[model samples]
Target chain A: SQQGEEDPQALSIQEGENATMNCSYKTSINNLQWYRQNSGRGLVHLILIRSNEREKHSGRLRVTLDTSKKSSSLLITASRAADTASYFCAPLTQGGSEKLVFGKGTKLTVNP
Target chain B: DAGVTQSPTHLIKTRGQQVTLRCSPKSGHDTVSWYQQALGQGPQFIFQYYEEEERQRGNFPDRFSGHQFPNYSSELNVNALLLGDSALYLCASSLFRGGRYEQYFGPGTRLTVT
Candidate 1:
């Protein structure tokens, strides 16, 4: 079973606009990580937010974790056409060796 | 530094046949994990290898097995493959500290079981 579920299964936006996707999980997690997958490729690590941290930033990406809600969100500011890809949120399980369980993912399309 | 690398970027096989995929971890990393991703779906954990041993695995059946070499490279073997087995196989490498959990991924091998 998937530990997390992301909302807005698909999102379409114009370049330079901001794209935000949210994920909700069922169990407690030690940390949450976000990844991006281009078409026909493996995933690329984006950012990671530990349970203790509320927010993190890297370049045009921003992520926030709310442990109380067991949810997290990824924000891509000033999106580019190249930013088009699928975004996934994977939460590390608390017990059982810290393996990650992924959500169904949100597909984002940035139109030029 | 080279990131994780996988072999046979793409492959096609008939159902019931066997297939083996390989992966070399990223430089300086020691742990390796495998994932299977179907079309339009998120990747699912297959198993993880560390120290030349199977450490943890996902819900996959016994047909899915793996081996890790001393150099930290690994192989994922699927026996009696099914049409459902077709998917992208991804290999990720990471270092296991006490509680850290960051993993780097390879470009992935696209497997199509016809």
Candidate 2:
């Protein structure tokens, strides 16, 4: 059992629809981050939300953090075919070396 | 400015052999971290180096070692590789503030062990 766990292993949706991904962690954290990986490519950081922060937004992405529940969510509004990729949630532990522990991730496919 | 960069995009190694993977941190980022990602799995933290010191390590064995230079470049050396050692080695770099940072990752090096 790693620090983070994400559900909905795979999702398929039409273009212009919204996509939501959820992640739950075992312990408290300093911050949580989301990343995107296209096929056969390195991951790209999408956004970060500190523990003290409940919600944050960037572009079409909205992230929410529930510290008491040890869970977080990422929402992509009006997702496009270009947004198709695997998304992961990383929870940075409170006492660790500032390294990020990632979840398995959710595979998102937005059909054109 | 250039993002994080790694060398030898793909490599093949045999069991019990040694492999060295190199990484150059992003501009202005002084900390380097490494991870191993197997097929269909998320990246697992291996270790992190900052200021030419091993700041933190994950649950990996001693066969996995790393070194950081004064210029914020890093090298990951794995010895006595097993078949399970085959994976994508990723290097991420970020500025070490008082606490943590959001990492920027390199394209990664794929290591296949026979």
**lDDT tens string, model 1, B1-114?**
999999989999999999999999998888999999999998999999999999889999999999999999999999999999999999998886645567888999999999
Best by DockQ: 2
Q: iRMS of each prediction in angstroms? A: 2.4, 2.5
Docking class of 2: medium
Report the poorest 10 consecutive residues by lDDT, candidate 1 chain A.
A93-102
The runs of at least 3 residues in candidate 1 whose Cα sits more than 4 Å from the true structure, single-residue gaps closed, are A95-97
DockQ of each: 0.57, 0.59
* Reference-based TM-score of each model: 0.95, 0.94
Question: Looking at model 2 chain B, which ten-residue stretch has the lowest summed lDDT?
Answer: B94-103
Backbone clash tally for model 1?
0
lDDT by residue (tens digit), candidate 2, B1-114? 999999989999999999999999999889999999999998999999999999889989999999999999999999999999999999999877855457899999999999
lDDT of 1 at A25: 86
